[model samples]
Target: MGLAGLRIVLVEPAGPINVGSIARAMKNFGLQQLVLVNPQCDRLSVEALRMAVHAKEILESAVIVATLPEALQGCVRAVATTARVRDWEAPLENPRTALPWLIEQPTQPAALIFGREDRGLSNEELNYAQRFIRIPTSESYASLNLATAVAICCYELAQYAESPEIQTPQETELAPLELVESYYQQLESLLLNIGYLYPHTAASRMEKFRQIYNRTHLQTKEVTMLLGILRQVEWALKTPRKDEKL
Candidate 1:
């Protein structure tokens, strides 16, 4: 099978030609889903359409959303590409090693996120992904065009999409990313209400929490259990204890 379940997400991409080129590349690799998160350029512009050539259908059918969360709706796995080293707990992996994992759950939707052409993904944006990638290049010229990066990853996806030897056994149904994101929001609110995280520091502290949870690949039931605990804790904080009433 091909990578039909994988969604390619571009975050605030600015170049029309680049977007078109990515669509054409996706067509070449048998990928169809294209999602644009607040694109800065008109995807259907002449330049884009011309570059897309025979792949114009992919561009026309692309999903445009206002936020990253919206673009990632219903996905079970997400891998983000980055070029710079950051102070994060997650180690940067190569495209060959990490791309295969995305297709392991072929029945469920997955996402591959590429960031802005100028700055790439921000720290907050990076938090949304379960894994990270950094394509190797010569030290003298490390920068890569956005479309080039997508094409390279697409090539890798096509190469391994049908390899039975690379498929990992699915032991359980993984939780949807939206479900896990909801839990994170609730957990952050509870922590802030209880003064565990101040307004000034909640984001950085939550980054650590995300890094921990992202690695777990929590199941759907596991996330529900976690949400239940958060809701109960929230209720407890509002309710007066028997001793306090006395």
Candidate 2:
């Protein structure tokens, strides 16, 4: 289980040294793909080049994109890194809980997203991902440097990749992120339509739903059951009738 096709996306990285160091870390962990979105500094600057050292090939092959969605195209699973604890974001999971799924599922390539060093990922950007990761640290200084965060997550991922006991059974197919996302989208819309969630508090309420389902680690059959439940609820809400009270 090599990190052959996994993609690491850095959104709006402003520090060239951090970028280069991230490349070096990726090389250390055997990751190849590096994507940058709207980088503020020259990724190939002399400073970056010097820091990359032996990982210049990763730097040279890095794909630059204009936006986050464009950078995440073709990725089946995406995990966003964040330092702040937001009530509306999915529950922050560690790399240990998250990385296993990536290595276990070989067919779908996973993407790890690191936000800007200063502000971290925006609310909208966080919504684009199904899950969020938080590095456990002292509360006084919870935020970690971009390169350090990358190194920690990559190291955890590499450890899982090297271990053989973490292998997943072939019969228990993991549901694709797209399918799970669609279910969440439909669930949220239906809940909003039915008055269970209001516009003012919709995001936070929906985040609870995300956390519950993600914790389940839903399989294909489980997802089908959930979709069926949502469909029934939606149909009940949509079906209108004349005033014929029983």
Candidate 3:
């Protein structure tokens, strides 16, 4: 029960110092897997190296990817870190609610995603995650430094990772990312086709739907059920009967 194999992804990190600090903190908390997506600054720079100190190995071994999807390739579960409340996005939970599923799953890899230093993860990126985690902070300074947020989350994860209670029996199997994503895509297209959602307002409206379903943390069975319902509705709307009135 450790974060030794769990991946931590930083999307578009710009600060070398922050990168190094995160590596050091990861080492301190016993986390090893680090992933960076299209880094803006040299991740191996002197400033970063200096900050990493003895944890330079974590920095050196970090995988760099061209996009968020590539970084999340093999992860069974992924959580996104966000600061502000998204209008159409699902309600954000604390680290406690989200981390348990990760710790309990021994067979599949899990990922924790942190966004850029200047701006947090985009809605598209956030949509990729099954759960959203928000660190409680003062309203005046709701946004925390990227590294600080990472450290706090990492620490909380460490607590659960090291606990024996996290080894309990699994309750339900989560739907695969591909399956969930496909559902969203199909739902969006069906809605647009039926004029339920206009092209101009599709993204925001779809996001609200995403929030509602995601917040339920739907299992594979539930997802399949919903997909069936969506397909039926789509078919009914598209099929023309001879007796139907225009």
Candidate 4:
């Protein structure tokens, strides 16, 4: 979706220096949207503004939210960064290989999600993303500072933005993450109603469902069809038979 539609989401970022540097990197790369989830540090603090330098406006204009899902409101595609290999089958690709996918939608909004400076993303947080990016570093010194990591990813995004291949349109379009999320909520409630998913196991079972849907690269219309079916089922469940006693 090019740089304009790309969002940089930081989850629980605790350092003003890191937050400011990330804002600067975003500006240097032409990206405009920034969403912070429950940040511990004051993003507008003097230290942050000093680090931001000429990109101070980015720091000032960032959207702050209480949760990751709120940060990702209307996004259609997202790539979450993690330091360790996760348990899920989703491949942890390098930024060069994966970041481009976030911008391929051209007209839609996409996101690059970063976790807290200390622990990276929890597995539950990682599930929100369809793709994952792991910057390759030496095994002896694998840790990259949060700001440095953001700089590397922003550079890769900028590189991909300039690629000739990215300008062409793809055959299929991804549904907005909001729409897909509605489908998930509906599917989960239905599964619960039918006893296919108990509250105790629903979260884990739904994770498997997420992996399947993410792998299929489901398109907008396909998700719409699924949502329609869910709506119909909900209607039937709520409707009463004429012969039934009041």
Report lDDT (CA) for all predictions. Answer: 0.94, 0.83, 0.84, 0.88
The TM-score between candidate 2 and the true structure equals 0.77
Candidate order by TM-score, highest to lowest?
1, 4, 3, 2
In model 3, state the lDDT of residue 113: 92
**Top-lDDT candidate index:** 1
**What TM-score quantifies how close candidate 3 is to the native fold?**
0.84
Pairs with backbone N, CA or C atoms under 3 Å apart (clashes), candidate 4: 1-103, 1-106
TM-score per candidate: 0.97, 0.77, 0.84, 0.91
Tens-place lDDT per residue, model 1, 1-246, is: 239879999999999999999999999999999999999999999999999999999999999999999999998899999999999799899999999888876788899999999999999999999999999999999999999999999999999985667756665789999999999999999999999999999999999999999999888999999999999998998889988964
After superposition of all CA atoms, the RMSD between model 2 and the true structure is: 3.6
Q: Report the candidate with higher TM-score, 2 versus 3.
A: 3
Which order, best to worst by lDDT? 1, 4, 3, 2
230: Cα error in model 3, Å: 5.2
Flag regions of model 4 displaced more than 4 Å.
165-167, 171-173, 234-246
Instruction: Name the regions of candidate 2 deviating beyond 4 angstroms.
Output: 66-70, 73-76, 85-98, 127-132, 136-143, 164-171, 220-246
Which residue pairs clash in candidate 3?
Answer: none
Global CA lDDT of candidate 1, please? 0.94
- Error (Å) of candidate 1 at residue 225 is 0.4
Candidate 2 lDDT at 108 equals 66
Instruction: Give lDDT tens digits, candidate 4, residues 111-183.
Output: 9999998899988888788988899999999999999999999999899888776665664677878778888
Error of 2 at 178 (Å): 3.2
